[model samples]
Target: MNPILDAFWYILPAYFANSSPVVLGGGTPIDMGKKWRDGRRIFGDGKTWRGFFGGLAVGTSIGVVQHLILPSYYGSLRIAVEVAFLLSLGTLIGDLIGSFIKRRLNLPRGYPAVGLDQWGFLISALCFAYPVRTIPTGEVLFLLVVTPIIHWLANVFAYKMKWKSVPW
Candidate 1:
């Protein structure tokens, strides 16, 4: 593949990882109402199993597609699967960790986390997959910094559309 195409292939997962559960995942927290009890689910009403699984599926699919379409960029099929699993798992774990911290701090669900939820996915994915796969530290930092802002923007849009109860 060409240099631009190679770059696109390399960045695919980063962009994919930046995708929000609020935007792609088909559940809404506003519909659950403001009452904390009604809003309190695993990671609040907005964070559903469907969203989690959907993210996993998306991550895995992206890895698989990259392996098929740009094997030269990503190496072996096994590596692709590992990367996908780690990325998706990392994203969900990060969001969950953020929720735990929020609860400990007495922050209510749908309360803006500033950038926690946004960055959580990437951090968790990296940490979780660290043992299995090695990624460059600079690249990791780039993902950490970029993913949250991307997430925040996505949330802003989701909030405007009433797809999410809060924008953080």
Candidate 2:
């Protein structure tokens, strides 16, 4: 597959794998805020054990897949587990940090940060992987800028299709 197209295709799945945990229902910010608050605990009623575990599962799975598919780009199989761990943990951590910021700002959950949430985890994942493997700073900035636009557009269309409850 063409490299650009391949990256484009993978972008959404990667974003989803990272951000899908914060679901919005009834298209209401308050409901999402409640859910978000409940989700803050180690295990609680909001984010849910399911969503946390699911995010970890999906994030790591994608890392493993990336390792397997592009060993050259990632690293040896031996490092794959470590890479997956970093990606999963870092992705979640990014969201957690974002949630913290949102809370401090009283933004409310499901309120949407425009593109920040969509791009935050991706940037965090890449940065977390930096010690293990290096990527150009330019590339990092590219993802920060480009991924959100792609994510925003995708969410808009998905909401229009009723696949998603809100468009951010």
Candidate 3:
């Protein structure tokens, strides 16, 4: 497969995981309204349990579908589940970490931090998935180049759809 296409296909779970949060997130914040010593919200109101779990479910479901439809594309069902779980979990964790940093820096929730907001989940997903599934260097590089643009566009679309308060 073409490197770009391969990377796009391989990273679908991460993509869905990163985006599902916005559509499904709400209610209690992950930090449970806690604050840091700096008097800032640990992860702000943006990070929530619903979002994290919802993203995981959606991403994993998609991966399972992909595996069932094209077994050769991403290896066995077991591997697919592993990839989905790790990528989805990693994406949310990375986003939470980003939010923590943002709060520490006194940046408000929904504020854009350039590459951090765009690439954090992808980087984290890659870190988690790499141990179980070896991704090609070329595909990794291609994803790195492509994902941010897609992230930006998705955020913009979400903003326009009123799902998000701001567009990055």
Candidate 4:
């Protein structure tokens, strides 16, 4: 496969993890409707249990299907599942961490934090996947360069579709 295509495939779990939340997330907030001493919502209403788990399920399901259809592409079924779970969980965690930091900075929910919104998931996914898989330098670079663009585009699409309140 082309290196670019390979990189995209490798990062699909993270992409799905990052994007699915906007569409699938709702219900109770992850912070359990709590607030900080500063009177800010802990993670805001955006970080929800439903979103977190739903994104994980969607991303991991995609990986499982990929593994079943193209086992050679991801080495093995077990490894693929591990990588998928790690990337998906990491993406959700990263988003939550970003929201936490935003709240600490007094930014309102859905406020644009530039790189934080774009790179947080990629950074966390890389960190989580590092223990399970060795990502080539080229692929890492490709992901870094491409993720923000893809994220921005996806957010725009979601906004236009009324799935998201903001197009970050």
Candidate that would win on TM-score: 3
TM-score of each: 0.72, 0.69, 0.96, 0.95
lDDT of 3 by residue, 87-119 (tens): 888888888888999999999889889888888
Ranking by lDDT: 4, 3, 1, 2
RMSD list, candidates in order: 5.0, 5.6, 1.0, 1.2
Location of the lowest summed lDDT over 10 successive residues in candidate 3: 1-10
Identify the runs in model 2 with alpha carbons over 4 angstroms from their true place: 1-16, 22-46, 157-163
Per-residue CA lDDT of candidate 2, range 1-168, in tens? 454544443343346556555443123222244434435422122344456667777766766677677776544765765666676667767766666667656665556885567867786776676687544555556677677777678678778876567786
lDDT of 4 by residue, 1-168 (tens): 888888888888989988998989999999998998888888999999999999999888878988987899888888899899998998889999999999999998889999999999889988988888856899898888988899889989999999988888
TM-score (C-alpha) between model 3 and the true structure = 0.96
Query: What is the lDDT for 146 in model 2?
Result: 79
Kindly give the number of clashing pairs for every candidate. Answer: 1, 1, 0, 0
Instruction: Show model 1 residue runs off by greater than 4 Å.
Output: 1-20, 23-42
Name the candidate, 3 or 4, with the larger TM-score value.
3
- The true-versus-predicted C-alpha distance at residue 152 of model 4, in Å, is 0.7
Off by over 4 Å in 4: none
lDDT (Cα) of model 2: 0.60
Model 2: how far residue 153 lies from native, Å: 2.8
